[model samples]
Target: MPRTQAGDPLTERTIRVLDAVLDDFGGRRFAVRDWTGRRHDPPGPAEFELILTGPGSLRAMFFPLNDRTFGEAYVTRAIDVEGDLVAAMRVAYTIIETRVPAAVRARQLRLLLTLPRAGTGRPRELRARRGGRAHSVARDRRVNDFHYSRSNDFYRLWLDEWMAYTCGYFRTDADSLDAAQVQKFDLVCRKLRLREGDRLLDVGCGWGGLAIHAARHYGAVVHAVTNSTAQAELAAERVAAAGLAGRCRIELTDFRALDDTRRYDHVSSVGLVEHLGPAVWRTYLAKVWRLLEPGGTLLNHGMTGKAGEPVGSPFLDAYVFPDARLMTIGATVRAAEDAGFEILDVENLRRHYARTIRAWRERLDAAEAEAVALVGDRTVRVYRIYFAGLEHAYRRGRINLHQTLLQKSPAGRTDLPMSREDWYAPPQR
Candidate 1:
């Protein structure tokens, strides 16, 4: 047990301030331990413990008063969470969302102001640098580079064998991550009704997993586009190694800049819509529609928020995704309809995403030493907390994953397939 200020006793005023904050927290299952070895246990069983390292810890975490500030405090080790990180994040999210009385808030602020400010050491990795206007091609490229241009070896430490970064489709909770990823790719192919020599366009293709899979399995010729130079290089290598050089073309270019002369029989955009920002949904969908031939199918897979929830958080925007935004399924469907797309099917894979992220976190934990060697401790910590928080959000219905299928029907003509029987039939060996 560490003592605060050379064994100085905790003041009554300090206890009062802590109590006020915890009272507003209700009956969350967590414990708090402040400096001087004082513990404030919850009314019930605790799933995690938050340790405040010094008298200045609370001030450092709350005085600046924003999610990004608190996040920086945690990353710098002023405040630490032990055991059940997902549960701890749930409580933290609730605290952020809760509103306290004005009088109580003022009193808490006064108490916090009296405490000394803690010294936070330099973090191993700095926060992402912001630049230019949001959603512009230059700005979007910067954001993509910030997240995806990190060393491919670092990502390979935990991602599936194919380096699929998006959600996986699990047949059951017991399915392995690799198996579920394969299932997800096959699912996309079946939804498109891909056939031999059919042309497929993969927008925002990460590492060329789905593109190679489609060419190898369904005999489809695929064109995949990405904005990250790192991803494009690795994907090109993977495509060549898979003997798909003639069938799959990997382009290091923005999806918006694709030539309009080319048209595809099927299009798939997985895990890409979140970065488009809400204002660009109409433009995004219109572009996809233009790239598809009449009677063509398009499958859009991405994360979504609840109907009335806001799209982005300051902490995530600054530390993690930087300008990424989420939209509700209702909003996405409306945008597609407005772009003259006929909705065919909508499926929510929220539960599977929860399992998928949990698996990633576990694998990353097992390879923590290797990850740190690859990307430094600060980057590892950022992703650790991010994956845990995302899993909790999916499990609690705060976020959702949707696979929406749409068709471009010209003259009320849609291609065949009256039933989904073909989707479930076992692949021919």
Candidate 2:
């Protein structure tokens, strides 16, 4: 009960705010509290807890923030989550999707705008220092070292068992990361219509996950190429462990150096193109075109922006992936066509990535005790922020994951008598 006239108005306003949040959250119930709104000095029991306190106390479920602050907190091991990060993200996104009043949204945007931009004088200076050119081999090693040499143990703490550093495709509700990875590998193989006699080339194969899969399951001869020495060595060890020594070979060489006369029936590169940078994107595509046999399929799985040329995130560049850059669909199409490969299909696994990152973050959070011990405080913080930031990017459509399937022409036309590759259920299901 309100004691004063003003108290009633405040109580009514709080209720409205809570209701609005719930409405936006697809009618899912939540217990909300006012840590930001109430309890100035002496924090009450309900101050941090999700419970009602008094007249102005509102109750609704609140999502753990996934903003820049959350990222920083995760990196620092401040906040934690209990279960199903993917579901939590979906709930969070749905709530964010609700249209807030223009005034409120504008105020939030203004605050964001007021934050000091992280820049080196001008964006041009940042771009110029990197000089849109692939410099000497010595210079290139710096970029590779910056990103890839960030400890295999550190990556395994969060990534799948196969050390797959890309978005996973989940099939069933009960599927674990291991299962999703196996399914994703099979999906790619099925998409390429891989057969036992097929000679497969995995471009930028990270730790040889796909190569091992193809060799073991489809009995394909796989040549996995990667520039990272750590990846090559680890991939070889993994292949030998899987008894795939006869069917697969992992090479520590750049795709540019692949000038073999033999062609591949299927070529795939998972989450590798962004490192090629702007200058070599075209050249990279040309190499892929030359590597694939006529009538063969190529799968390029990487991130892309939805609209106009997306600028790189400064925070990500400095703290996460140093030389990584995202491309747009239009640019990818142009590059593939210029390289003489016809685009057969382009699927945006944008939402799937949001879910994937959420799952990864959740897993990382769950194993925090062990992860922090394995990699220390700084590394854990970096990943927490990285995964959350990545989730936000995908959810907001700022960045995306695209699986574009391209095919080289055999009879000057792409039409082939291939069986239906949809024999297995779709990835979304």
Candidate 3:
């Protein structure tokens, strides 16, 4: 690394820390050490600069007290990555492992668990623009933009080749994301009791993963709805490619626009309720209630809260997912009942989510460079911290995930189905 021109203490310390971390990683990976200041065969500045300035480039952001603030700033986009995001992540991880002692790391972890967050305060500018109905024309567009508007290239880094943005179903320690996503898709299909010629509706479909799977594997006609325009277009293209365009349709709209005249035999939503906001959970369930045909089954796969209401993670609200809310199992069940759906089953896959998130974060760490090149440093940092924090939360049991099976009663009876023969994969254990 080059010497600080002004010999400032913070800059000097940062450079030293960066160098030490890079050196350690180089030792582990047996990769060449590329330092700008030290006498090493480092990557050329022009090459490094290109890694930063080109599309998908990521620049590293260094801070004086990473333990104190990096996590929150990343969530807020307060810290930016300029170029070569993957390299930046490798560097950051190395710095943490080498520059910070184990004792300090433990202390930081404890602090994170106990620290209170700032009040739920939206930016003044954002407050000025609060629109009616969280998912209204303006607010809906903003929510879509907050997530799907991100670069496909950026998503490609951590997500499976199919670009599944929902949770994965881990069957074994050896199952890769490619296999796990397939597993998850099959699981949902089985749980919903999909049958040939059955019509299915996917609410909050992300890139139409579940819809495409059902139509292709189960021979079901599918209609999918999403709030993101990017997802709708991509899903349409995928459906057409699979020659399921006739069988599956992707709609770029909200659930409120659904025509009540139409009903599906099967319904599934994955990881979508988080964006529904706390105030609308009941209303959203009512929409689901009205969308399902009599005797139809609805599968809601979402992350749940261990406790009702907020824990005040301002960073998550401001940077990661704006206006997102999590509901406890008790509240979610009541909401379903209020919508007049009988809750036939509730399965908590909390541990699976912990493993799933770990897998995702690891994959993101591995593909950091490609991600940064696509989105830039700030976004890369945002994802890294977000993934890490989420992993911690899940492992600590502060959050939960569930796959609830709800049914719209035909004769107001819950004992219609006796055979669960096809409702699950063979015991993997």
lDDT of 3 by residue, 306-389 (tens): 773344344566666767778787788888887888888898888887787777778887887888788765567667766666
Q: For residues 197-224, could you state the per-residue lDDT of candidate 2 as single tens digits?
A: 7999998898889899889888799999
Native-referenced Cα lDDT, model 2: 0.66
Candidate 2 clashes between residue pairs 3 or more apart in a chain or in different chains:
30-60, 30-61, 31-60, 31-61, 32-59, 32-60, 75-381
Instruction: State candidate 1's TM-score.
Output: 0.93
Instruction: State the TM-score for model 2.
Output: 0.71
Model 1 lDDT vs. the true structure? 0.84
- Cα error of candidate 1 at position 39, Å: 4.6
Q: For candidate 1, lDDT tens digit of each residue in 293-365?
A: 9999999999999976556776778778988889899989999998999999999999989999998999999
Worst 10 residues of 1 by lDDT: 1-10
List the lowest-lDDT window of 10 residues for candidate 3.
Answer: 50-59
- TM of each candidate vs. truth: 0.93, 0.71, 0.71
Clashes of each: 0, 7, 16
Which 10-residue window of candidate 2 scores lowest in summed lDDT? Answer: 40-49
Show where candidate 2 strays beyond 4 Å. Answer: 1-140, 418-429
- Candidate 1: how large is its RMSD? 2.8
- What would you estimate as the lDDT of candidate 3? 0.66
